[model samples]
Target: MVRRAKLVNDAVELVPVLQLFSTETYRRVYETLLSEWRTLEELKQLYGEGVEEALRILKNAGMLEIKWRMPSDPAGKPEKEYHVSYTHLSINVYISLKELNTILNAIFMAEDEESEIVDRILEQIGRGRISVQHISRETGLDNLFIRALAKKSLKLNLKGQLVEPAKNEEV
Candidate 1:
């Protein structure tokens, strides 16, 4: 039980982990882990016998992995513990004019219009992608300004360039 609680707590500590699973599953697993450690049977019953199925799905989707530990008992080892390993997904996002406008509106609601500040924050937090913060810092613009500029930039955007053009080729 303590082990299960620990595992759930670890997942909860990482917001992305919670986001990886469906809300209901996250809530139920959280609640269950918070309580006494449940046997596989108990877990199955709690999840309408779909616990295994759910794990299978999560595993297959590369979203989660489970590790089983042997129970400490005189009898032959039982599946003692189950731990969930969550995978972080990386997705490249290309924003259309409309989407860029939406994001700009959402981030610019602050009275200070810390658009530039926000962009800097995003850039600093980039995960193989440029964030608003990066754009803001690079261009010395506010979040709103950066956002607008980014929209314009995207309009003229070429697909991500994998290899830089050689000196002789057009830039």
Candidate 2:
């Protein structure tokens, strides 16, 4: 079953698969799989055997393209390898520093809390739809209060503006 969950801000959404890749693992595999076409052995060497399954997950998510064939040579058969394919999504989920932190935090907090709001805030911020002034005025809260909340959860620094957290700190 494919489960589609709306992104908090509704700009981006997620398709739930049984095999969920962590943010870092997803980037590593995506880069490797796209940069140079590799057989499952090469992937297992760099990312571990678990990556074969991860690749299948991405394929099912429509994020990867797979090529499978059993070649019979005059002397012996050759193993199958995958080819690089264009990623369909335009929003670069891997490039943004702040959004990465927000996603990581959400993953950690998924058990006891509703961190979808964090993703919503990030999506709006990324789209330039939400601003610090707007957030403060809309919520009728002070800048410090908002920043504190952001810090506690997403670790973002919303002092001057609702900006991303420092790369050194983890939420």
Candidate 3:
């Protein structure tokens, strides 16, 4: 007896939710839940032990909704499935110059091979408001990846004449 979770809120707080899944396994479990509702057994099988605990934490935080299903067979037991409740997750991040530098520093800490493109994108965006096409042309990065990362990771406001960091988000 699976049912769609009610979308009571349009968005949820992302940072605290992110904090809940600090470990890689917990993150993987949460990502799996985002894709689709799954039974505890299914999650446990897919993610190994401690998945039940992770699901419980997410459910308690209102990030997941659980529906119980009573078995049709006389001797069978009840089962539960979990679904992500919110349509969006919002993070009110105040990215100061120091924080931005920290992010850049962390990116720089990665292997040079992997950080080259990321470094270029950050450098281009740091210059001023720019179009994804312009950034792509300048950075030699794929436009789609640049666009998505700018909007998602960098929190760019893409609706205006020029792409810019979202207003009220200090950089």
Candidate 4:
């Protein structure tokens, strides 16, 4: 059976929920759950392995609601069903700089290829905010990967799929 709950309004707490919402997979998952309930298996079939992380993000962001349902057999284990916790979202844009700093950490050399990705993003967005798709085309890195790097770039600001130079600040 499917469930469609009334859209609930919840003001977001901070960057993670807002940031996760900007992701493609997260949006797709949220859309999928809007009109129907699905077991993990069902979601996995649609999204493959990416569903796990996406679901985790949704759950952590208070955007996914879950309930357990009994299986067909009397002795079988119950199955977990999932749906959207809220359909409406609002974000207050007045976060403190300290909190913003927490989300917009300076890009660091964490591993191989990170520098390359950061370099690419920096080079591409010099004039203005550029689409993640454009950076993906130039760097051959996936959009999601580039987004992850952009979030950490002190020199960059991420707004949805767009990445731009950090303003009124020295790097």
Candidate 5:
């Protein structure tokens, strides 16, 4: 019987990437790929089960590139080695207006201190203020957290000396 391919929508694509922040296993697998290429076997040895699905998700999101392929055993089945396509994958996320609204709404609804900081950072960036140093000083949040939240949750891209939201090409 032929297996149907899983349909990936915007939310589905975002889940794996978002999980990198909260899930230890996903974070470890992603960080490992950041340093060097690894085969499925090697990833399995290190991350055990769920590594395959996690790699598939990242590959679908355009974060990982196949480095090479070689036979895993005498049967000669090809095992592809993979590595991060960019040093910074978060910058590659394509956030639609809908996704951006959803992210912002979540931040607004959450009572956490970090959420408030992120909201302030977004408000500052949306107003044509793109400097991380400026946002950090204004929001009183750490520079690293502001940068990470902007790149990861808000899908901002660092171009030259400025960080801005990933342009919605569909617009």
Candidate 6:
């Protein structure tokens, strides 16, 4: 088999691909196909019942393909052989910035106990402008993080070096 690469993005296909080596049977079946094409019965004889499952998973993930193999002699039964399609695999793990924000928002929603942390930070800010260091000392959040959360997240209205969260609470 030539070296072919498969790109797996969906979770359904990715699980089996990632487990190809660790799952034992999947690795065996894949290696078997890599060496040469084999019929279902040939695979069954070597790996037993698990061969079917491994083939199904590998086939669905674009790692294997089926081809018919005919007997050399007359009146002999033909067989369906499984061949490997790809010898290499590639995975995509990048998530869009919008998706990342959605996930972060879910974990930090101001509800019940989680709201206390938000309230604590909000309380540190007075109606008048205050320094990021003051908020960090009171809330235990880092100074740089405080500035980012203020301007980027809480939409704090900044006046030069200082910010007033009282104005952000309105938004």
Candidate with the greatest TM-score versus the true structure:
6
Candidates in order, TM-scores: namely 0.31, 0.38, 0.42, 0.48, 0.43, 0.51
CA lDDT of each prediction against the hidden true structure = 0.40, 0.49, 0.56, 0.62, 0.60, 0.61
Worst 10 residues of 4 by lDDT: 6-15
Rank by TM-score (best first): 6, 4, 5, 3, 2, 1
Per-residue lDDT over 42-76 for candidate 3, one digit per residue giving the tens place of the 0 to 100 score: 88888898776576556535677778778899899
| Candidate 3 ranges with C-alpha deviation above 4 Å | 1-15, 92-171
lDDT of candidate 6 over 34-76, digit per residue (tens): 9898998899898887787677656545577888899998799
Model 2, residue 111: distance off in Å is: 9.3
Model 4, span 1-171: residue lDDT tens: 344333322222333356455667767777888778888888888877767666665654556788887899998998888887666544436545654453444222353555666766888887453998988887686665566466544445667788886664310
Question: Could you arrange the candidates by lDDT from highest to lowest?
Answer: 4, 6, 5, 3, 2, 1
**lDDT by residue for model 1 over 8-123, one digit each (tens)?**
22111222232325447544653564444445566766766545544433332334434455656768666633344432333445546765454445333453444444444344
- Best lDDT among the predictions, by candidate number: 4
Per-residue lDDT tens digits for candidate 2, residues 32-80, read 7666677777777888645654665455344555555565666766666
For model 6, what is the error of residue 135's alpha carbon versus the real structure, in angstroms, after optimal superposition? 43
Give per-candidate clash totals. Answer: 8, 0, 0, 0, 0, 0
- Local lDDT at 165 for model 2: 41
Model 4: residue 63 alpha-carbon error in angstroms: 1.8
C-alpha-based local distance difference test score of model 6: 0.61
Alpha-carbon RMSD, each predicted model: 15.7, 14.5, 14.6, 13.5, 14.4, 18.8
What would the per-residue lDDT of candidate 5 be over residues 88-132, giving only the tens digit for each residue?
323345666765655444333333765565567668888878888
